[model samples]
Target: MLLSSLYIIGITAEAMTGALSAGRRKMDWFGVMLVASATAIGGGTVRDILLGHYPLGWVKHPEYLVITCIAGILTTGIAKWVIKFKGVFIRLDALGLIVFSIIGTRIALEMGLHPVICVVSALITGVFGGLLRDLMCRQTPLVLHEELYASISALSSILYLSLLNGDVTQTYATVITLTVGYLLRMAAVRFKWRLPNFHLESETSAH
Candidate 1:
């Protein structure tokens, strides 16, 4: 029940962010919905396709799609507020990342996947939606940029799996993972902690 509620919140937050991106591009309503839906569920769709999981989440639960669409349209009316309180959005996004990661890990575990595959699934679920949102908006994918986004997802999944392996209760494990994951992401953002970049300078021609 907790996971389900968090999943809804995660999708709604993601949809709003996607809508904001579309607004920046001056896209139409249809474009807003498209980007919003992609940002909210694109990761799960990709993960299901790769894992050969039948009936994608949004497909099975059409209400999820409706929620994202509604959230996107609503965002259009409150874009200013969203932009004005960017920090709140960032925190929400961080929470969503952890929620998505936990969902992905649980699904893979139910499928009897290897731990490594489970981690990969979590990473894809947590990061791919934002990647799609950025790509559709003609922006660089945040996953490819200097951020600990994907790493945090993987770490959260690993922690969740580890707790389960240690014989922790599902509820407890989830709570612990969510708390740690959210803090890690927020700390990364606050400290500008990120993976190193590889910058190749242009060769200067000898005059």
Candidate 2:
């Protein structure tokens, strides 16, 4: 599966970043592996659980899980290099987000789920891994306050679905989605594009 191959790339890249995070916190080897696994597979796991999908990807192919763990360990030795080349990880993460979204959308579509559910699935797949990583590392959830992360995932899912619905070839739809999604994310990061955040200046309730 095209998505499966991209999924492996995404997990490997995500695991490297997660391992970098662990190093920043001075975590032990076990902590690096745990964070890496969660950051790489946590979103898909959450999405599967919510959609009641069985035989999770890692469960069906445990090698992928092992890959993430190994990636984490390797990062410990390459921590300085990883941190210095953080921009590379940013690009990988952008690509990973699109890959995860497309995969999630396709999964729900395969299950005959509603379009809305498919979009939600994409969102969960793209964002939850970062969310889980942040929670574990005691850092702020960047998705909530940073660039148009979740929105990009939603847009990619919807656009991909639209192309497919319009009878476009699966190959074209995937290629176009990957290109557009990747550029949009890079632009968002460059410009610091962010969704409007809600701020409360009062303690009063609507009641």
Candidate 3:
């Protein structure tokens, strides 16, 4: 369920970007469709291999690729309108991160991974795919920026694990962890919250 939802969000983000490109790049419909598919499935492909899942998720289900292509084609016509909604991508991205993180952690735990490994897997599931998409688009990933993006995912995964260990209800634990992660991301965006950079300039004195 989590993978499916994230896949949709990834495709949507790709389609939205491709659609809004103003046709200056001369990409035809097929090119746009290919880009969308790459963006949506790139990260999950890596995760599935790490988890030892054969054939990958979207590969085993060709419908995901078809749907992503259709979405890309549709976005080409409505790209301008979609771009006008400034917060749409950011909001959806946050929600996707929350959902995917929780689901990834849960799956890891079910597979008998240690809690720390589960948290790491959750972060990978949430952010790695998007990172690959951004790199493909020749842009810096938002997660690697100063923004508290991956931090929120990491914290949420930790929270979910702690709650699970405490015997909290599975459904409630998942809901709370996702909610916390989403709200934290939203707040970070609203407040321009960021982690401090380590680089500092020092004044040099001449004798």
Taken over the whole model, the C-alpha lDDT of each candidate is 0.94, 0.93, 0.73
List, residue by residue over 1-207, the lDDT tens digit for candidate 2: 777788889999989878878888899999999999999999999999999999898999999899999999999998889879989889989999999999999999999999999999999999999899998999998789998999999999999999999999999999999999999999999999999989986876776
Residue 106 CA displacement from its true place in model 2, Å:
0.3
Pairs of colliding residues, candidate 2 = none
User: How far does residue 87 in candidate 3 sit from its true spot (Å)?
Assistant: 1.9
- Weakest 10 consecutive residues, lDDT, candidate 1? 198-207
The TM-score obtained by model 3 is 0.82
Count of clashes in candidate 2? 0
**Model 1, CA-based lDDT:** 0.94
Candidate 3: tens digits of C-alpha lDDT, residues 12-97: 67545543342334568777776666655555566667887577777788887887678778878777776788688778768877
| Cand. 3 Cα-lDDT | 0.73
> Which candidate leads in lDDT?
1
Error of 1 at 56 (Å): 0.5
List where candidate 1 sits over 4 angstroms from the true fold: 201-207
> Taking the tens digit of each residue's C-alpha lDDT, what string does model 1 give over 99-156?
9999999889999999999999999999999999999999988788856999999999
